[model samples]
Target: MTPTRARYDAVADFYASGWPDAIDDPASLRLLTLLEPIAGRRILDLACGHGRITRELARRGAAQVVGVDLSAALLERARAAERDNPLGIHYIHADVTTWSTPDQYDAVTCNFGLSDIDDLDAALATAARALRPGGLFVCSLLHPCFPGGPNVSGSWPSGGRYHDEGWWQATGELSSLRRQVGANHRTLATYLNAIRRQGLWLDELSEPEPSRDWASGRPDAARFPVFLVMRWVKATAQP
Candidate 1:
């Protein structure tokens, strides 16, 4: 596992404990909604941490569902969950940056995992390669702007240097914000451009609504979008 994913594996237990905001997380929900899988279509859940949506896809009647992650710790938990249902989900522990899949899936999804990936281009390329022509590539990531301010570094009035807001960054414990924890950060433009480079045509862009609970308790949560959802189709070089 890569250093970033490994870090998440070590902390996988925290998420399973019912990440307080799990139900309110719009990123994963948006991706799942866009997938719209048929009962027998093959689906790939790239970087499926703890198999949350992975299980959902299988339950929704996908013919084959595969969840790949770089962290063994999280994969272990995913495996445990699969054991209960035994729907035959293939769990792979590998880095998406280098993994490859032939034209094997009707759809590929990356829910809240793109921004954390180091090689965004390679990852998108892999997703594109894995899909048959005209197949869909659905993914969600941190909004390039808003919510977290400018992801810049500067000195605050408190007289200490600190890293400011950034894409795909979350603050955890000790008033410290961790950037690029399980994945790296990328701008919205960068994402679109990368998908194009991977022979995928942008189809739609969506921003999911934060759950009612989150909006009520965290006023600023909706003010700044915390997630972005995108749908793309494989390009066919035809007139």
Candidate 2:
């Protein structure tokens, strides 16, 4: 198994149980709001942990939804949810960086997963190939410019270089509920360039804040962007 898969497998249940609260967070709410009118669209959800957004898409009227992830343990949780709720959502055990299907989807989404993928280019290419011409790709990620690291100051430490790749462990009050995971930190230009290389066109970008209740406690978070949401569309014809 890939190291990322193993790491997620180790914390699958914990991650799933705690992440659901994020569904109500502003970034998530904005993503769902942006999806708008999914009555008959087919969606491919990448790195879909526990199928929270996958099941939500199906519930919101997506004609068909398929979720792919590297961790079988997480997919198992997703499957259990499907069994009980019956959203007709299909869960696949696969690596997002290399997985492909004979079929294409109307839309592809990855919620807070891009930064976690080791092979960003391959993953973008896979998403582009998985979409029909003119289909949409939407994703959210930890903001590259201000990714929270060891410091709680809400600022990149003065004179400290932003490392592009590393293993990060969560600590303090939330330590038990989180895991030390591998992550890639790319600049805004790197992400935009990757999307362009995959033949996807940028359509929208959003930096959403946490909800009032959550932000109230961490006021410093409001000063700098925490997450980034982007919407891209494939071209009708390759150049």
Candidate 3:
């Protein structure tokens, strides 16, 4: 198994348990806002841990929603949810980097999953390929400019802010799960360039604030943006 898969498998339970509450997260809320009027559209949800967003899309009237992730353990939770709720969302156990399909979708979404991908270029390319011309690709990520450090302090060790790449092991409160499931860091330029290389045009960008109810008592969240949401469109001209 790939290191990323193993890491997620190790903490799949924790991740799935916490995902229900993640809708209150600033990024997730923004993504939902951007996905408005999704009825009758087909959506491909990348790195869809436990089908939280996938089920939401299905509930919102998506004609079809396919969620893809690398970890079988996480997929198991997703499948269980599907069985109980029956949203008609399909779950695929495969790495996003190499996964492809002849079936095109109306939109592809990746919620806070880009940073977790080691081969972002490959993943972006695949996302582009999976979409019909003029289709949309929406994704959210930890803002590279101000990736908040450990905890909600929004503070980092000297020079830590500029780290372009490395493994970020979780520490403190939920260190056990965080340590097992680490993330990679990519520069903002890297992400933009990857989209450009895939012939995708930036349609929208947002630095969303956490919901008031969710940010309460979290001073740092109010002070800084924790996530960045972007929408890119597949251009008519192939890159």
Number of backbone-clashing residue pairs for each candidate, in the order shown? 4, 0, 0
Score every model by TM-score: 0.82, 0.88, 0.88
Which ranges of candidate 2 are over 4 A from the true structure?
Answer: 1-4, 147-159, 163-179
**What lDDT does candidate 3 reach at residue 52?**
85
Model 2 TM-score? 0.88
Candidate 3: where are CA atoms >4 Å away?
Answer: 1-4, 147-150, 153-163, 172-177, 213-216
Per-residue lDDT tens digits of candidate 2, residues 1-239? Answer: 44254458888867888777336877777777767767799999998988989988988899999999988898899999899879899998888887778899999999888877778999999999999999999998767776343333221322444644433443423224323564555678888999989999998999888677755655655567877888899999978
Across 1-239, the per-residue lDDT of candidate 1 in tens digits comes to 25344667656777566543243477777777788854788999898888887788887799999998888888898898889778779998888888876547999998778756777778887898788888899988656653333332111212222233233334422213242243354456667888888888889899777677755655544566656799999876643
Worst 10 residues of 2 by lDDT: 149-158
Q: lDDT values of the candidates?
A: 0.70, 0.77, 0.78
User: In order, what is each prediction's RMSD in angstroms?
Assistant: 4.7, 2.9, 2.7
For residue 9, what is the lDDT in candidate 3? 81
| Residue pairs whose backbone atoms clash in candidate 1 | 116-183, 116-184, 151-165, 151-166
Model 2: per-residue Cα lDDT at residue 207: 88
- Give the distance in Å from residue 126's predicted Cα in candidate 3 to where it truly belongs: 1.0
Pick the winner on lDDT between candidates 1 and 2.
2
The candidate with the higher TM-score, 1 or 2, is 2
lDDT of 1 at 34: 81
